[model samples]
Target: MGLSILGLSRFQFAMTTIYHFFFIPVSIGLALAVAIMETMYAVNKKLVYLKMAKFWGKIFLLSFAVGVVTGIIQEFQFGMNWSNYSRFMGDIFGAPLAIEALLAFFMESTFIGVWMFTWDRFKPGVHAIFIWLTWLGSTLSAIWILAANSFMQHPTGFEINKATGHVRLRSFMDVVANPQLWRAFPHVIFAAVMTGGMIILGMSAFAMLHKRTQQHDGDKVFFTKSIRFGAVVALVGAVFATGAGDLQTQFIIEDQPMKFAATEAIYNDTSDPAPWAVVSLINEEDKTANSIEIPYMLSLLSYHSTSGSVKGMNTVNKELHEQYDAKFGKDMNYYVPVTTLFWSFRFMALSAAIAGLASILALWFTRKGKDTLMNYRWLLWIMGACTFVPFIGTTGGWLITELGRYPWIVYGLLTIADGVSPTATVPSLLFTNIVYFLLFLLLGAVMIFYSRRVLYQGPDGEGELPAGKARAAERTSPVSAQSTGSVSGNAGGTERSVALS
Candidate 1:
């Protein structure tokens, strides 16, 4: 059967949101990486760091451009496909989104241009400030956006307006200070860092493989340092992402028990020392799942103890039905998509673990100016192939976040059906969906094409080095070149001109 209006609208939103989100982390990650690389160049006055900053900055620009285009479309979706949601959430959402636009987006956009064009105008340390500000603006943008989303996950700082029957903001501070927002904010930030780090690490590995064949000693030094830098960033991000994820899970156990239960595929109430499911064959129709269990792990996961029992989906469902059915009325299925959440949670966890593992291996192998990584061609190939690993985890994590809150667009406040625009038709949704898919496909292809083109060109290639002054710096010592800001600026100017063109 064809999808109904609700189904099609939801699908379209889901697909578009996911696609938009895919680039967001990459932009955020690359921005911070570029900022740090530039800062290192400013501090140590190393031309190698300058080369890294310039090369990666191009990738960041591409990602940021696509992210902006996709994000603009997302804003329109609220009014076009989910007008009711907009009406209900207008008051609560307006402040943060406005702040994001007026303060964060403006700050980011303004400084990014300054950073790009003024590379030749400012001193190294002074020039680095612009990219740092750009990172701050982007991070702040995420914070405000997540504050609005957190309200949907766990409604706070709002009251029902009796006259309009819509939610109005009660305290802006409370909304921004939401516990859920903080939990989710750090998790997302760290994940983005990991995503960007993986990209750098993977690209470096790919370059190393090619550079070895061509016997380019300069390129070898560039990629080697880059690989180590990427490894450190990725490892730190993975560690923190995992920790932040655990905190989110703990919060979920308290604030959204149904979601926790669904993730574990638990149907029946468990004993005091509940076993954690390793894998489950979920039968949603029968409200049953045959799970491969780890003794006392569920208790540990839920309560951080091996003794306490947690409510299962069946129990949570019964309680929710009793609480909400009276107001919303009858046949309310409280059970979420068990199979989806179960695997999504696992995939997200596995992604983090893999990132952590790869990073540690990278660090160990390349310790103390060692060229051990060159010995493992297989490992380099694998690292290059695993560029998309963190993306998989991030996508799966979002799926669990959105889907686990089934039937409700806003927890305990609005149903998905009520939030969807009642006037939206299947035909319009289908047409938009097709258009979005094609548009995203084109953007993705362009991004990949340009990124590959950059890699193929190599770091020492044309436009990477400017004419007279940059060549003069190459002959001078690294420390001596610190005083030669004009020479370095010319190189940066060349990169900016190439990237922008």
Candidate 2:
């Protein structure tokens, strides 16, 4: 790979997007789940359930803080590294993102504060209302961002600015009504939900393990329910991800055939019985794939019918299309990462399938009317696996979707070459990237440590410690004597919660 500012920008873009998404998906999914759990607890008047909701909400708060911090970098990168691409597509792209800021982000930021501190001050009914609103805000925040991204993935109805030489908005309705928005939005939300389920399962597993082995029955009762709840969500969300993901995949294949062909490394114009590239260890120079493939899979998937021709990269791209006809005109440096995208996409899909089945089985065993408590070992195993599956699936899915786009920053509207900073060379960009990457790594580490601290201090719905404990503990700095009262069984059984507040 030759070094170029565009290439470095791609790497930087990839790194930042991956990091931002890591937090956003989990926050969206977990926030919804937290709201639902709290609502159920409020109606049922179950203290344990309420306690469980409070515990998970603490973790959600941690993830939300990190999500917002990292997300700001995404908007910044557009101007800093991808200025030209932004200038070209901003008129079109900025519309939804701007709306996202005003409508969704503002709602999320404002009410989250209202929800957070109101627990002690407000009535349960009022607080629940705020919690529901918080969930609504997060969902809308995701929707608007996805709308902006979907437009980039598949540009739709827009007019050009003759004066500015940039694509401009003709109608707001067209931007909102873009067909890609319908496909991309649901897929991303479902993925977010899946990511949330994983975290729930993973944390609950740790809690379960801690409780069961040590015989902390108080925590186990709530955490076990948490595991069951997480499993159900994971199973459903994984299926949702798959269904929505396939829809977009099919759309991409049908509409962007050359894009699809290049994604699969089909160089020659081959007709009839389109062979699927499965598990190819390809030599780029020779263009030979020495790997196995199940024949006819691609044909069935793309067309919903077998025995049809799927054109290769060279044949379709070489055609002398009407440059005057393609509304924006076809001018692009043809690029594709057939091997990387193909495998990454498959890995993501396959992992989701595994996670879904595992979760379903776990849910089945868990919901067996108290009998499931006998086979606690299986929940423990599945819970451990559930925690990491979403990460793998998300990372893989992103690699497929983002890398598959190859040299385009804005689908057909802009190329990666045009997006590079004119004054900066590859080395300069690389230097900046190294600095950014290291800073990001440090930031992520601090966030994780802070999250762990938050989890340790919270999960208690009833203010367990005395009100004065915080002040006394702060003055002493990480060391506190036992309460003035006699030591009870509670102290022996439960570890002290280190309050972040």
Candidate 3:
């Protein structure tokens, strides 16, 4: 019954978190893009720029709403489903979460409201500042959350309390400055940027394709610039994400050698040089695997020296058991599921590679002009469909990071089985899992519906300053232009010759 409850609780948390993250990358990425667009509009005073900002801002708001709704439940689940884990690490983990809520979530929500309502009232510069603040808030929120997660991967600045059997915060700065956090944070930020860029690229491609068929220039220039901007940003994001991922791998090799070995399916210890497995067939019972490998590459990549030795999973596990067993007083399973980690790593790497190549191709096609971009129908179709690639990579990367931690909920200090809530029941966990899944399903549907509606409407609907001001100016402007048989221009300079009643 205890194991069943633990499994259910893990499933529930994983489901909720995965759903929450579906919207998070989109929200963060879109926030940055919208902020950039608003900044450009404030400086250039271009109506098209304003249109772009408002259009994308709508999608960002929808994503943010869904993300927040899904995120709120995760907090409750932490206390209810895994009370033991919460109690064990809450002292150290709760600090960053509290800061996230107080400093980041509040700031983001408040500024978003101010930015939304003050569109017509505030000056363009002030309005842009509000959106920029919102993006900054979102980024700060991510940093704090990542800081907490990093603590789980590499426990630092905390000492275990022998009396209470709980971890206590020893150095706040160490928790915040964990090497894992800094290495992982940049990768997450870059991935968010890439996700945002791909969304813009895909949506702009759709709009452009629609305009081509419909013979409408209403948003041609807007989406043209959007695609170009997205391409450049995506290129930069993909490049940085790749570099950050490499650095993160190096860190993992140094900090969590067992995870690295398991990820590569290296079961036996090797010295002088080690081969990087491209693919492997593992027999868990026998503790062996047959693999296709590149000689010396693993050593070269892991230590930056071809001659450096790389410890295998078997050696690392034995050493971990010997080192920790005496202190923890329990048999430990240090080896994570190699199959899951191995495939997830590959999926993340492949998806990122594809996104990078697509961005480069997009930049190339858009560099010449819109006409040249349109010349390749296949490329446009690919761009329009490539929006989900970053999300895939982000999801897979997260799975690898989280799952690689395995039995230990807080690295070497705590096991996940030990962290399960003693009072949790199987039926309650199962019920909540179903409920949360259905709740997110409904939320996801609504998000999709609203997104489609906004995309269909384009940027010509309400909240457009030029269109609204033009109508207002037309009503009060001199009647001589209306009464006189002559073409007249209002505040927006679009020629109009009509007699008013």
Candidate 4:
């Protein structure tokens, strides 16, 4: 086995995937938030809620657009760089991807277009329904994608075809019901919601600060409500994310013991009650490390009992060799990069903790009696800066998940070494890597620029109505009679009604 083509392919895939994820969580989170705001508008007929929905909707649309463009490349790479793996899993893996496109993507895109154009054509309640449908589509899309990935982590309901050297699906229901899918799906969804909430909270903080300096109460109520909403959603998401992460860890310990051992830097088997390592200096060569240990915590976490035994890397590796060496004709090392996994896990945990705490503070300060909370400018600044915390946590969690899998592309079925395309060459892969890197960089830059511009504009009247509908609104509401001629125009013309055509 050589590192030539295989290593470069892994690098390229990781770079694209990480970049792609930067937009996905935000899109998913914002979609749900937008739907809630629109629903409020539908129920109360308040123009402020409509303005809120429109402002956040602009950001969501940009994220969804860029995410879709970048995601297309992932499918292509599966064929171009990892053809062998594609061939092997095609029978079982292709089904979910196909379903995502047919059932979710089309539905999301179609409703988004209708929602965008029908702003003045449909009644407010009907318009809200369109946005809700779009949100449903986006949520369904995530479920399908995660379902496909969970199969790779803990494969289920598949049988090998001896004649053709492929795995075929035996039960679609089993694939959808995989325990790992349920564990991972909620974590990803809540994290995405947290990401969206942070973005809204941060941007709202900036707007509030900017408005406060001007002594403007024109949009004060609007942005203030947004801050409270974002904070509450973020707090709930953080709490759920922590619970889901704990469940995921228990699943990991059960299904991939070697990965669990590697994550904790465990080298040698210990007694029935194992201590959890808090911090460690790993010495891979000597298979020993200096560490702080929390007595019985690992056993408690792994089995809910302090007396349960947890095997370490040394013992697990020996067992794996004895069981598979002759059958696979190779010596397998079960250890992953211990230091990287250790730090990534800690960073992810710490970030989630910070998000939770910050959200609590934000919510408390923004409450009615705690109007004094806004007087502290530094708190607002901190809340604004926390926008990136969920992104960092998300990236770290994925790194730990994918990298911890190490040699296997599909657990217990196919090794990454056996998965790369036979025609892949170091030179070809390196050139393509540069091309893809530059292409995505340009796309990412464009997405950032557009998002910033929209954020600064503050969703006043942009895209609120089509040209024809705007003309119709102009005729129906005489400019001479009202201060502003637009639909649901506010006192200072800074806010507009979000009525759909």
Candidate 5:
């Protein structure tokens, strides 16, 4: 099959972006988690909390490092693959990215280093401040990044320069304060938090299982506390994520009705008090769907009541053609990938519900002197598997956000066809795509390897963990002098310092 430059460029970008985004939420979420763990240690001076902080901090650092590397590559693609889009959006888009790099990223990286290296140097409370700062910085970084993205979605705070045929920033405050940004940012942040919570809950569950098998009572206690903490965090994130997602969807109904319409696979104008499609058999060629819908649910969801009519794809497309035909072209297609949106929305929503349910069950089973949790091996398995589920939800949400925009790169201002770089060749794009794919595979493998290594090693660096199932704890008579006092495991002669370990 032949690869057009535009198609290749889009594919390459999609691959790189998806891979990059896989770690962004993880990093942001983990930063908060690590900070919370450290703060708990600071507040209680509990050795278990200290162990929790150190153990999870390793994963946080790894995620942050990989995210930074992938983010650099993501930024480069803007210039390399979408030069025309960059040239058009540079004045509007560049500001947030610049602030993110110079202010937010710099603050995050610096404090992260401090937190890592000076763990023992500062008092507990002071050292904890560094991680809290890192979390704040990472959060701020997300805000700036989303601010830039929101501008593309809504295109506010800018004026189209007639002479140059480019958008110019009219007000920085307005761009940063975009209503779309506020509506979307909470959903993303809470999702990130949920992502973090799931990872912690899963890892802790696995650790608990391993320790229980080994009959290491101390380790089991450590993991039990951690698992419960993770469950609370997960539940909070999941609950807020759902609420925020609903609010964002409500905004989308007004702001981007076609996107909302496509998500439900609605082609014809809906009756007043529209029905919500639970499932659909969509025909792309015919632009129609055979749906199983719930009465008035769509109207309730869209307008917070069961009264208003929701516009459908066909109706919106016709209106769009009429409005933009003179300025753009009559042949412009406003239709998006309906099937993808239909499935993605369901998957995203379902994943969030699953996450919430798992968290709730975990909390219930482990409640008030209940030793029943361990007996439910299936529950543990579900919790562990949930580590990967939030990624699916986040990925699906992003797919809807970006792909639903479809023909527009900077909605209404520029089309995706005209945004790609003219000079990008098929061969070069293919080569880079292959290279980046292989690189991502390597990164993924390394992350898995190291993460597993950390899990196997447990909170205590007493023994080297084998590649397979949990092994018996090998207690050493002599403790390592360099080992941190906070860790519960007996540090053997082979043990390294906490920071290095």
Candidate 6:
């Protein structure tokens, strides 16, 4: 096994990332949705709007807590597992990362804490502002983190520090403002929105599926409105994600040709024309790809011309080795993991296609008091299936990215083998691995179970939730001036809805 250190680190990283991502999309989407509903309530002086906002805000709050905890772990892992990578790219990557920490992360974290414990204490108008602040911070945090990753794919505006064997910032502005960022970040944002949408739609569908027995008359109406809201938002996000994904494909072909070749399983080692394989492809093998393919699809994606060809992985690998030797005065291994990148890309594409179609079709069938078509048994089944699609999409995007950067921990500067602690023995790694694996398993299960309990057993269970919780009541029922005036807040607090807004 030589060590399995790489395998272990990869596993731990993936598990942590997947778990963290599950919480984020919902937090970002729900925050905005809640803010809009609250604003509507304040404007119209309608309690239904307030009830709607508070109920959904409760769900968002749950997602935020889990997201924050899981996210902190991801930041620490970069330093823990890939310390060498951090040292090498720290100057460049650390810029956006630091900004995210200072400008976005702390702001969101602080405001969220205020929002959570002070609903009864804050003014209604002021509280709404804090919510919006949290929402912006979350999304901004995403943009900065993504800016760092974009630099990896298209290593822009950095100078080599030969003495340190690392890249230094030639211009911090250049690293942060790469053109690649504009595309990748929006694509990720839309994907996040889609994940949020599916969760909303999936829950709404579950309620609808069991409509006859819903405990409260108000519950059915809320679920119906949510279904409309979710299906529409999901469809819009899906369409944006697909378009951005296409643009990303084109960008990858030009910026990381080897990765593009590896992803498509192009092994013939030629250029000037590229073919898009439409199905599964066998790698590190002889004979042709076993799949349907469009002869010039890759060409158009790569060069904006039907006749131009994309390079193959074999040829690109050979060239990379030659280039490494020529540039560094030494032989080097060009290790690109084909299978992981290949499957992850396909999974992302396919799942996205299905999610987009499902959302749109669901809306068309159910729109404008026209849900009979959506009442089809299969549509319900697909809606249920949509709950897991975001998980798949997030994981797929992650694997394609991290796997594509194999061998090198930080682009051309450091390899994974060089990143491990020399004094850290295999026995030590194994012990830690076992501990982390068990701990992680327990943590993941607890989060899922807790979240499910909140979703399934809390509202729909036997008893009604306690009143006087502004945010909690908002989600379960339409809030009125009655709710606003119900609480005698603590001294230095608003009269209605106790905790400080």
**Best by TM-score, which number?**
5
Against the hidden reference, what TM-scores do the models get?
A: 0.91, 0.84, 0.88, 0.88, 0.92, 0.85
Residue by residue across 351-442, what tens digits does model 4's lDDT show? Answer: 87888888888778778866555587898888878888888898888888887787678877888878888988899888988999999989
Deviation in angstroms for 131 in model 6?
2.1
lDDT of each: 0.81, 0.66, 0.76, 0.76, 0.79, 0.66
- Which residue segments of model 1 deviate by more than 4 Å? 211-214, 463-501
Report the error of model 3 at residue 222, Å. Answer: 2.4
lDDT of 5 by residue, 1-501 (tens): 149888888888877777778887887788788789878878977777777788787787777667766766776787788889888898997788788878887888778777776755789899889988988888888888888888878889999889889999999999998999999889988998998888888887776667433476666766677788888888889899999999999889888888999899999989998999999999989987999999999988878887988888989999999988997899998899999899999999988898888888888888878857788878888788888998899879988898888788887888888888888888899999899999999989988887876776666644355533223333421112233433222100100000000
List clash counts for every candidate, in order: 0, 0, 0, 8, 0, 24
lDDT order of candidates, top first: 1, 5, 4, 3, 6, 2
Per-residue lDDT of 88 in model 6: 74
Q: List the residue pairs that clash in candidate 5.
A: none
Which candidate do you rate higher for TM-score, 2 or 4?
A: 4
For the record, the alpha-carbon RMSD of candidate 2 to the native fold, in angstroms, is 7.7
Give per-residue CA lDDT, model 2, range 108-215, as digits (tens): 777777776556566556667776887787777666666666666776777778898788878778778878778877887888787777788776665555433235
What is the per-residue lDDT of model 3 for residues 1-501, given as tens digits with 9 covering 90 to 100? 144987888777777777778777787888899888878878988766776777787788788777777777776777787778888988997788788878887888788877776765678788889988988888988888888888889989998898998999999999998999999988988888888888888877776676432354556656777887787777778889888988999899879987787777778887578788888898877888898989998888777787877788888888888899897765667778888777778778877787778878877776753447767778788888887788778778777787788878888888888887888998888788789888988988898887765665455532223676646544432211221111121110000000000
Candidate scoring better on lDDT of 4 and 5: 5
**lDDT for each residue of candidate 1 in 89-183, tens digit (9 for 90 to 100):** 99998999888878888888888888877766889899999999988988988998888888889999999999998999999999999999999
| TM-score of predicted structure 3 | 0.88
Q: 1 or 4, which is superior by lDDT?
A: 1
> What order do you get sorting by TM-score, best first?
5, 1, 4, 3, 6, 2
Root-mean-square deviation per candidate:
5.5, 7.7, 9.7, 7.2, 6.1, 6.5
Root-mean-square deviation of Cα positions for candidate 1 versus the true structure, in angstroms: 5.5
Which stretches of candidate 5 lie above 4 Å from their native place?
211-213, 463-501
Select the stronger candidate by lDDT from 1 and 5.
1
lDDT for predicted candidate 3 compared with the true structure:
0.76
Q: Kindly list the per-residue Cα lDDT of model 6 for residues 398-450, writing each as its tens digit.
A: 77666676555555656666765444455655766676667667766866665
